[model samples]
Target: MHDAPLLPVSRRQMLATSGAGFGMLGLASVLDQNSVHAAAPVAPAVSVATANPLAAKAPHHTPKAKRVIFLFMNGGPSHVDTFDPKPELAKQAGKKGPGGKWMPTPFKFANQGQSGI
Candidate 1:
């Protein structure tokens, strides 16, 4: 048996295959223009003396606290064991619970700061 000869792709076939990519580019441009025009007007920019963006600016209204920092620990230390120490948990350690016996925290906490968490 003889094998059939492979045919080369024509310019029309190539253009047809690539038409979707060109269409997507055109659609993206149109969507971007619509979004730009239809979007809400930007608020007037706050005038700053310094070039640095990190430089602190005066709040519109007086804030109770001057600054705030948020710490997010994903799959980190348990809150009860670390921040909120429970002495009763130590006494009830090794006691059976809903699933298994309760385990005590290894770290010992002490009163430190003036606030004393």
Candidate 2:
């Protein structure tokens, strides 16, 4: 009975669940592709008033943000040590590290001229 329980709940369960998930996902993808092929081709647009689902529209209200600056680091930055200041960031302060784990910066910060394009 001991070996029976162990065998029944062993690697086979994990493999079966994962295999079934992938199989269902594949089947769904095939069905979606088939349905797309079965769908009728949309008629060519005739007028500017012809509504396009993806067309841009005027906002209901004034936009809060006009410009956005996205500074994407090659790797993730330490939130606490960089922008987000925390009271308990002493452990993460001044520790130089790499990868996705917790890390700290080793560079000096100083005020410079206005930032622009």
Measured by TM-score, the strongest candidate is: 1
Give a tens-digit lDDT track for model 2, residues 12-76.
77898799899999999889867956666577667435667567878899999989999877777
TM-score for each prediction? 0.35, 0.27
Q: Give candidate 2 misplaced runs (Cα > 4 Å).
A: 1-30, 33-37, 44-50, 53-104, 114-117
By summed lDDT, the worst window of 10 consecutive residues in model 2 runs over: 108-117
Q: What's model 1's lDDT at 14? A: 94
Error of 2 at 81 (Å): 5.5
lDDT score for residue 65 of model 1 = 91
* lDDT for 101 (candidate 1): 93
Model 2 residue 49 distance off true place after TM-score fit, in angstroms: 7.3
RMSD to native, candidate 1: 16.9
